[model samples]
Target: MKKEKVVLAYSGGLDTSVILTWLKETYGYDVIAVCVNVGQEDDFEEVKKKALATGAVDAYAVDVVEEFITEYIYPTLKAGAVYEDDYLLGTSFARPLIAKKLVEIAEKEGAVAIAHGATGKGNDQVRFEATIKALNPRLKIIAPWRIWSLKSREDCIDYAQKHNIPITVTKNKIYSRDQNIWHISHEGGNLENPWNEHDESIYMMSVAPQDAPDEPTYIEIEFEKGIPVKINGEKYDPVTMLTILNKIAGENGVGTIDIIENRLVGMKSRGIYETPGGTVLFKAHKALEKLTLDRDTLSFKKIVAEKYAQLVYDGLWYTPLREALSKFVDHTQECVTGKVKMKLYKGNCVAVASVSPYSLYNEEFVTFGEDDVYNQKDAEGFINLFALPLTIRAIMNEKKIKEEKEVI
Candidate 1:
C-alpha cells in the first residue's frame, strides 16, 4: 500500500528540514516539499535539491515573485497599511500568498495534509493556518512546533545534528530571518531581549544609519493610479523598480527599524526589519497622495489604513472586509497619480517636493503676494463659521453663570 503523502511548506532551512525528517519518522507519511519563492535571495535549484536529499519524495520550487509584487505588495501599498504606525506589514502580507500556494500544490499532489514549521508562540502559525483554513477547509494542517517535542532552536539544532541533517543554524549564531522582495526581518537570539542592542552585523539589505554617507541622495518617483511606475525618469517593471530603489536607499542606511512589537499571539517580541525600497516607495506614494487626494478622502483613508493594516497583520487577507477595503482604497487612488522627489540621507527618506495634475492647491487663492483671487475679507466669515460651536458653547456657559450669580 502507498503511504499517505503530506505537502510541507519547506524552505530547506534547518527548521523545515528537520520537520521534513520528523514528519516521516513520526507519522510514517511520505513528505513532499514545496518551496515558494517571493524574491528572497535563495537558489531555488539548491533548495529543491536539498529537499529531495533530505528525504522528500518529490520537491517543487514555485516562482511567484512577479505575482507577489503585483497582487500582494501593490495592494498593500495602495492601502497605505502600516501596522502600529511603524511596521509596513511585509511578512504579514507574504504569509497568505505562501499558504495559498501550498494549498494549490497540495490539491494537485493529492496530499492528505499540509505541514509547516511555524512556532506555537509566534503569529506565523496563525497566519499560515488561517490562510489554509480559509482557502481549503478540508485539508488537514500539521504544525510540528506545536506538537513536536523539540522545544527551542537549540533542541532543533541538536535534533538536526543527531540525524546528520544538513543545517545552517548553530548554537553560537542562530537568528531566525524571513526575507522577500519587500523587506527582511530578523528575530530570535539577541533580538529576543528588548534591552540588547541589535548587532550591526545582522544588517543584510541596508547599512547602519551612522555609517551612511554625509551627502544626501535624491530620486524622483512617478506613480500611476497609486502604483509606482518610474524612478528618476526611467520606467521599469515593479520588481526592477523595487530592486533599484533598494540599492539606492540601502546605501543611505534607510529603512532599518529595531522594534519591540505586540504579536497577534498576545505576546511581545523584538525584531529588526530592513525595508529600504519599501520605505522610499511608501513615502513617495504618500507625498503624491497629499498633492492629489482631497482633505476628506485623505482623512478617511487614514482610518481605513489603520484597519487595513490590522486586517493584513492578522492574516485576514482572504476575508470579505479586506476585499471591500481594497476596493475603497482603489477608488481613492483614482486621482493619486503624480511625481514625488525624495531626499535620502542617513536612514531618513523625506519627500522634498511633489506634484500632481489633479492637485487641489490653488496658488491664486492662497498666494502671499496680491492676486486677483485674493479673499482677505473672506477669512472673517470663514473663521466665525468654523468656530460657531465654540462661540455657542461660550454663550451658553456665560448665561448659566449669570443666572447662578443672580440666584446666589
Candidate 2:
C-alpha cells in the first residue's frame, strides 16, 4: 500500500521546517515541499536540501520574481491600495501568488492535500487557505498550526532540535519575519507588546531614520501608465529597478513603519515593516497622479482604492470584485504616466516636482498672474450659483425667525 502525498508550502524557516517534518510524522503521509521565490534573499539549493533531509519526498524551488512584480505588485501599485492609510499591502498581495503556485504544483504532483505553516491567529492562514480554495476547491487543506500540540515558538524550536532540523531562529531573537522584493515585515516576540519600542536590530532592508546620513539624496523616477519604468534616467526591468531603489531608499532611512493594525481574523496585530523601494515608488506615483488625474476621477478612485486595499488585505484576490476593481484601476492608470523628482532624507520621501503630458493642471488657469484663461469677474457668478441653496435656506430661516418674534 502507498501512503497519500501532501504538498506543503515550505519556506526554509523555523515554522515551515518544523511543519514539514511534523506533517510526515503525524499522518504517515509523503510530504512534497514547494518553495516559491518572490525575491526574498535565500539560498534555494540549501532550502531544497533541508526540505529533502527533513523527510520530504521531493523539493522544488520555483522563481517567480518577474511575474510577482508585473502581475501582483504593479496592479496594487496602480490602484494605490494602502491598507489603513499606512500599510503598503506588501505581504498581503504576495500570499495569493504563492497560493496559486502551490495549487499548480499540487495538481502536477497529483497530491491530494496541501499544507501550510500559517498560524491559526494570523492573517496568512486565511490568505493561503482562501487562495487555495478559490483556485482549486477540491484539494484538501492542512493547516498544522491550528492542529499541532506545539503552543509557541519555543516548542517549535524544541521539536526542531529533537528532529535535527536546521533553523535560523533563536529563542533570544525570535521575531517572526516575512520578506519579499517589495518589503519585509517583523512581528511577534517583543513586537507583541504595543508599548515596547521596536528593536532596531531587527531591521534588515533599511537603516534607522536617526542613524541615516546627514545629506539628502535626490532621484527622479519615470512612470508609464502608473508603472515605474526608470530611476535617475536609467531604465530598468521590474526586479532591477526595485533592487536599485531599495538600496537608494534604504540608505536614506525611508519606509520604516510601526503600526497596530486590525487583522482580517477579527483581531489587532502590531508589526514593523520596511518597504524602502515601495515607499519611493508610491511617493512618485502619487505625485504624478496629482498632476494627471482630474478632480472627480481622482476623488472617486480614492474610495475604490480603500476597497481594493481591503480586498487584498482580506485575501480575496481571486474573486470577481478584485478583478473588476483591477479593470477600473487600469483605466485610471492610462493617464498616470509621468516623471516625479523626490528628495529622500531621514525617513522622508518627498516629491519635489512632477510633470506629465496628460497633466490636468493648467498654469495660466491656476496662476494668480494675469492670463487669458481666467477672469476674476467670473468667480462672482460661480460662487453664487454654487452657494444658492445655502443662501435660500438662510433667507427662509430669517423670515421664520421674524414671524415667530411678531407672533410672540
Q: Per-residue lDDT tens digits of candidate 1, residues 67-105?
A: 999999999999999999899988999999999999999
- Which portions of model 2 miss their true places by more than 4 Å? none
- In model 1, residue pairs whose N, Cα or C atoms come closer than 3 Å (at least 3 residues apart or on different chains), thus clashing, are none
Compose the digit string of candidate 2's lDDT tens values, residues 1-408.
998999999988999999988988899989999999999999999999999988899999999999999999999999999999999998999999999999999999999999998999999999999999999999999998898899999999999999999988999989888999999999999889899998898889999999898999999999999999999889999999999999999999999999999999899999999999999999899889999998898899999999999999999999999999999999999999889999999999999999899989889898887898787898999999999999999999999999999999
Worst 10 residues of 1 by lDDT: 366-375
Q: What are the per-model numbers of colliding residue pairs?
A: 0, 0
How much lDDT does each candidate structure score?
Answer: 0.94, 0.94
What is the C-alpha local distance difference test score of candidate 2? 0.94
Residue pairs with clashing backbones, model 2: none
Q: How do the predictions measure up, each by TM-score?
A: 0.99, 0.99
